[model samples]
Target: MKYFFFFLFCLLIGIISLTAQSLHFGYDISGNQELRILQYDDDSQSIPLPLNPEPVIIIPVPDGPIMYTATNGLEIYPNPVETELIIKWDTQIANLLVKIELSAYNAKLIEEVKFRASDQKAVLSMSQRPSGVYYVKIYCSDGRIINHSIIKK
Candidate 1:
């Protein structure tokens, strides 16, 4: 009987794959071990399958620098920095207090600077730092946070 149910479940999964829908399998957290199916119309959402299914979890891996920008008038360059890095913001945010933080890939704080955007620019010297991956976070007085990735060469 157990084998029959297993075969039936396999057949059911085969049929479900024929349709344009998504199947999410999960167990009930209350120890019920109930099977749940979630269907989605689009393929935007996905869950990585375990390699062996032995209670293994999948994690997102980074291939390269994870960079993100939130401000339009702000610029940081040149990436893969050699010695110095420059940050600039337009006059639109000139009156806001600006704070820049440079950190290592492990999220260790390296350096920080605070100034008014009216200064038009700020320079961070990376000449003394070793070549590696780093991150920069910007905090604005108006509650805006920006992030960028930097590579030291």
Candidate 2:
């Protein structure tokens, strides 16, 4: 009976821990002076910031011919997106104006949107767009500009 109780206790603890959410911590290097924590709803994959002393996380330059970086705390995910694309940034710039431009490979402008930085995240729908390579340009009110290439399938 004691062994059974011990097993039940351990099982309960394991279940609780397994259901707990995980947080990712990283420093916002965009002169925002903010700490960003990323939370995911699902457990299929998680990319945590490296456990290092440096507060900034430097993403490797993309293999494409053109690459651009605007300070830090800027993240675009699910490269080669299917239907939707997510753009995330630090909350510190939430009050500033952010301009996002989407263009085709031939420099044909597709869509443009402007919003306050506080939104932090933007979900772009590509359902109507054709499957091809597109360019994303982010113009921040703080004189910061970032360019990235994305593929839609």
Candidate 3:
């Protein structure tokens, strides 16, 4: 009877541990099957696994309104710029009021300017700013807001 009770206690513990474990399966470089069962204790740190070449595909189906550009002639140049940033748009959108904002990575506002859009071009100086990543947000009068990421060196 004592032996039967000891066996039962061990079986219960095994079942509990199995229920608390996480299992992952993948193929190794040699085309062999790899199974990983991990259990984390308070002192153990978890490390991320390397990305698999064949990953699961997730297709996004948007449920809300989708915003798209009405015109395709918008252009910006000299990415990773040092001194100046140029913006040019379609001639059809000329003379519209545009609110241009330059912001840091943390959404902190740095400079804001309002300009009348011209098909020719508009130049913005970046010589005074330090080297970092910045975002330029252009808000058009037709409710279109475009965002461009720029790096200043």
Candidate 4:
């Protein structure tokens, strides 16, 4: 009986797939900040299925330098972000410690991430957190410190 129900559920999903749409996010594999997109058809006979109708991005990823280093410079964009945030440096960094501090009327420690710098760029997701001013500090193994302020909404 359980197997029968499971089969029926999958069958229903398959029927729904005919009308569902699929979305694909483009990532730069060459380590450069270039965006390209490729999609598959629903009739694909592969073991793992792909997006049904293929996703169409209304906004395109603008071209620019994707990587940076701490020595050359440090920068943060779109000050306030919900899901993800990008950090760029101009020089090669070794040990990178990222600290996010929240300060509005008062300052408080929110989160901290210690990572080895790679590819000159890093993305952080902040789906959680309140709207306000955030201080992101980057500390390198060479004893250099860089800071950027972000606002979350």
**Residues 45-120 of candidate 3: C-alpha lDDT, one tens digit per residue:** 6544544457679977434322224355666767898998887777765655367788999989988855556535
TM-score of each prediction: 0.52, 0.50, 0.50, 0.41
Task: Pick the TM-score winner.
Answer: 1
lDDT tens digits, residues 8-118, model 4? 999999977755545445446775423433434566532333435555779653443233344456656656688777775554343344442333335466556534465
Ten contiguous residues with the weakest lDDT in model 4: 61-70
Q: Is candidate 2 or candidate 3 better by TM-score?
A: 2
Query: Between prediction 1 and prediction 3, which has the larger TM-score?
Result: 1
Q: Would you list the C-alpha lDDT of every candidate in the order shown?
A: 0.76, 0.73, 0.71, 0.57
Winning model by lDDT? 1
Clashing pairs in 1: none
- How big is the RMSD of model 2? 21.6
Model 3 spans with C-alpha error above 4 angstroms: 1-71, 95-97
- Give the 10-residue window scoring lowest on summed lDDT in candidate 2: 61-70
Q: State the lDDT of candidate 2 residue by residue for 22-79, as single tens digits.
A: 6755556675433434455576656554444465788764343324445566777788
Regions of model 1 farther than 4 Å from truth: 1-71
Decide which is better by lDDT, 3 or 4.
3
Q: Look at candidate 4 and tell me the lDDT of residue 35.
A: 41
Least accurate stretch of 10 residues (summed lDDT) in model 3? Answer: 61-70
Residues forming the 10-long window of minimal summed lDDT in candidate 1: 61-70
Clashes of 2: 2
